[model samples]
Target: MSEVKEMAAKQERQALTGNEAMALAMRQIEPDVVAAYPITPQTEIVQIFSTYVADGLVNTEYVPVESEHSAMSAVVGSAAAGARSMTATSANGLALMWEILYIASGTRLPIVMPVVNRALSGPINIHCDHSDTMGARDSGWIQIFSENAQEAYDNMFQAIRIAEHPDVLLPAMVTTDGFIISHGMEIVNTLDDKTIKDFLGTYKIPRNLLDVDNPITVGPLALQDFYFETKVAQADAMMKAKPVILEIAEEYEKLSGRKYSFFEEYRLDDADVAIVVLGSTAGTAKVVVDNLRKEGIKAGLLKLRVFRPFPYEELKEALKHVDVIGVLDRSDSFASLGGPVFSELRAAMYDMETRPLVTNYVYGLGGRDIDLHMIEQAYRELLEIKETGKVDQYVNYLGVRE
Candidate 1:
């Protein structure tokens, strides 16, 4: 951001719920098309944006679909036709779009969806949890998790650039916790419409369906031979997304003065025990770490921002110095071992010459509350692991009554 714009942005910070902040960001960016289906916490976003269209605030087509499945389909169709497109949805809504999610990324569409993280259900819930997004980790989309409303707002612009980057034309989802970030209000420093417009520049696709002079097919069925190659190509693009994500983050930081990375490190230098987490719970964990430090305990936190295109190598180097690390997951993978994050981190650290002793802490599934006490217990376990040089159990559930 320019110095004057930055100062104005700081002064004009608005108190908004995550949904309102995201909708406002969408308005600022003003993509060509927005096709969405509302569910619980995510409903407010499109509801707010729909009013923008009605009031002539943004020149964008707003499609209110019957279901999340149709919502994703609408964006995919619009994006393939070379329009900048977006959507928003919550847990069950996200699940409904499962099939189309893969097709969106597989066909290399730079669609952006803001997902409000909620527990995926058989018991049926409408509250905060990571199960919804965690279940779609391998669906060929870039997954960026937000800690609060501010990140949710900022990430929308960054996600647009990242998804539309020349080398990384993949669908992306920026997620915030349901009820936690989505319904709660916080002050967000927002860029002006002109700044976001300049940041996004223009939306272009090399071979869009609408280009009749240079017609090309999209989403054709591929059998065993070519399909394997397509998968490999998509994987290559996903790996390429890491650098693109970071580069865009640096540019965004210069613009907004809010730095972001694959993960955030909090006082890791001299700490012996640390906690690794994702989403809003990281905020709670930070408080626990702060209190632990005041008592002379060497504790720290690493809050992960990007889950898909997992930063395996960078993460290993970051945590190798710590003695014991507690990797917390808000979703249960239920493989009889632990959650998705624990398995990935353990594997990532496997080859580190001086790796930290890591244990899994599965907490806050189905929107169960994880208070400061739960985070403190996680740190306590880490301290014990550091002191004894032993991990009694690799997988442990937190704040749950057996």
Candidate 2:
């Protein structure tokens, strides 16, 4: 414990924006290859990393691709060749990689991506929102969300380990809200190069496409006969990732003195009303939870850090005690019922013996501000639902004019 504490004390604390933190982490990792196309919010990440490559700060093979689709394809090829590979993108950029996203995961390449969350384009908006990543929720990649620059940095280290683990050889992405965590500066405690290298060890995949002596086909066509079994294997791998994620997080805590879990619980143990949220909004919700607690309102918060394996069972256990819960979403699902996170939470709690009243609040679309007042109102509404034992509407939009 003393050694761990000493190691933590030795870590350098630096002021950086979320994109810079991610870039620094990548630099320390010194991945063999990086293929990315520039996109708003996420552009700075690749831009900074490219400089590292040019200046010989890191011996990385940087590939400037034409589009997000080509970028992902390039990463897939590099990773399949058993090289550590990564990329960064946001919004429409992620949308462009939709096809390759599935291919990377399907082929079980451990490619790490930093998806700076931005609103998906249609009306043409470039701002903080989960719509981009949320749209790719079913793309078979491990998804982790960060609330601040510090978390974004830390999660980047964990993501590489998580994705490359033998039991969980799948693509993984770390997400930070665009222009919120991405562009905003904050203090981040970063591990030294040696510590990070030792912690991540070496990039060694069990199998690779480039292995000529013992070769195996990747992404081969499987029509109906073996497709189901392959999918089962993928599902099993995802299930196995839950425990691996926890184990890696525990080890990370030992190195950095910063603990992490699938979801962070803030005063949720004995609360009657709670709000659940993701990304930067969790910070605002935490402030509201602290204020409400001071007022003896019994309000609490559940901030989801991992959204991929969904943490269904653990989350169900965490929120089991609350009487009423508000699930906040930065992007709507357009299903008319609720947003992505909200719908998932509802499904997780559906089988519980005594379920709490859960409502969905879609807020902060197109980078709209989600102030403390708005978060407080969500908690207040939860209180009302708890008292009346009735929810007028299951889905509600926050900070929007009706």
Candidate 3:
């Protein structure tokens, strides 16, 4: 009986949607505060979490703020007050919190936000896209993208540890594709509550605003004299977070038996053509890679899990041997050059000894369906590029009507 109980306590598998997984992770963490506003695709996360708060499953201070901007502001204040704070948002909700996003990161608050990746509004969209989070890539937060419900839950646990690490005191966010991952259900293995609590331990703020004994000033005005140095310090923290992220991932793997890194490589051991992507599209791309492999086409994939601390060196090393690389971006940079991932990847390969020919494929904007056929088309283009050593157009749009 004792042995059976111990085995049962180790792990539990259940079907849960991406939003439910995130909410469950938060419930397990038992954060001190969660201030969030409802947004499409992101509503279920907070809705489910609020029930935990109401039912007293977790002793959390649930702040039902009026707007996303206020929600983030409340989290910043709570975090500054030495509380482990978090929130969830998507699309325009994230846009409303743009100003506070900088404040939280600049103040070095270890706030964890779960972003349900959605297309930002201009024409007003409530669908899955990378525009929302990609627009805020430079906001100094440690950004991690999830490929499925399992990754979404796992990344939330990792995000808490990553943000709170003393060496990497920065805000972090875990993102999943809106409507797709957020609404779709999948089997997820979750650790016991006690195990999660043991792993997370306690919240520690090195220099919180509410530490009356030490009395520190946060977000003080420093015009030309000290602002530059402060910004540089934030930049340094972002750089330091990369190693800390990997270390925490190592620890997490021991507990969950799931391995994670900056990026996931699939069938790339010896490949001539490859595709680099993020979010749920990686899963689609992998299926396409498997099909191409069966057809004797050397194709591979590199799915980026971490975007902010953009794994430049690791990416360069991963793709150096490939003949051609296709970077698929869900959001357009509108720079006329390429999308965000494409621009960064192209720049990363600039100084490589044997750089692979890379091209940009912008796809799946405004919840556009990126089926296997579209992915296969992209791989076909890569094979052509590899053979010809020429790119008819450096920037191309996939699954879009001209």
Candidate 4:
């Protein structure tokens, strides 16, 4: 038949929004279970995947729940039952699942959730911000930030492999900026279904609650007598995930012809002034760095991908030579001092032999525009710090009306 072709074909390049790309990856993954509730910004992902389920494109049991809490609970039950499970959410949806988030991780279920980063509500905004995931950063899940649609697509395959790895049996949340990357269309090169399937191999629940022959408890009461040890074990697994993530990324690179590391260092080695950021903002920062370099400003940028394990050591080594640094945040920490990213970054470099003057620029809350001009201003401030050897303002709100 001329209809069917060989599976070894080159990757297919298609224009896809981040939500569609993530849904496409899930269709290719064909996980055993996907229990989710619709939420702004993230609803499209599961909605598209539901179409796959309807069209018989995938064999996944799609469960549509009423609330994010129920959505997460259903997946936790599915994951504990030894099913490859996944879910997607945004903003308040993630906040609603706060209780179950810990349960999913505490039980060591390798559930993969695609969190569309959105600002948490009091004012009820349905836009991009890192506050949702940053709020759950300490919940024992690996946090991966995507710069664009392609990373969102590629990270899905890697997230499943990383989460299910025996040495690191933990959940992972691959995140994308709400409307910025989630709804923005871009050309993405996607692997064929067979390629991704082969890459994922097969998943067998090592501690299967469904396995009657080798029955084991999923989650039981842990007081101070064993709560500390249980936490230590989970912490150890999280630490082991660092190497597993890199290893899985390496394999995915060979299959996809795209390389990845914990974070991307864009012209940072010889930099005198550096900017460190996460999510879609990094894309804007890279452009600013290129223009600054053309003007002979030794400017550089580092875009962090993995945020949970923190990559403290690698970050320390990478920024050791830079003269001054700036960290831009899309979400305010509201702690009065600085945002979560800037705070963690300062702590990471605290023990350096000669730490650079660091500045925190909190911007883009509630999906506010963070354009090239704003990013250029951040770099200029870092240059000032480099020149004067002092930071006039340690923390700032970049585009606020004051």
lDDT tens per residue, model 3, 112-207: 999999999889889999999999999999999999999999999899999999988999999999989999999998898998999998999887
What Cα-based lDDT does every candidate model obtain? 0.91, 0.93, 0.93, 0.91
Per-candidate alpha-carbon RMSD to the true structure: 1.7, 1.2, 2.3, 3.2
Q: Could you tell me the TM-score of candidate 4?
A: 0.97
- Candidate 3 or 4, higher lDDT? 3
Q: What is the lDDT of candidate 3?
A: 0.93
Stretches of candidate 3 off by over 4 Å are 1-9
Please count the clashing residue pairs in each candidate, in the order shown.
1, 0, 0, 0
Question: What TM-score, over all chains together, does every model reach?
Answer: 0.97, 0.98, 0.97, 0.97
For residues 1-402, what per-residue lDDT tens digits would candidate 2 score against the true structure? 687678767988789999999999999999999999999989999999999999999999999999999999999999999899999999999999999999999888999999999999879999999999999999999999999999999999999999999999999999999999999999998988998999999999998878999998878899989888888898899999999999999999988989999999998998999889999998888888899989989988899999998899999999999999999998897865899998889998998999999999999999999999999988888898988999899889999997
True lDDT of residue 268, candidate 4: 96
The true-versus-predicted C-alpha distance at residue 311 of model 3, in Å, is: 0.8
Task: Give the local distance difference test score of model 1.
Answer: 0.91
- lDDT for model 2, please: 0.93
Q: Point to the candidate with the largest TM-score.
A: 2
Model 1 worst lDDT window (10 residues)? 3-12
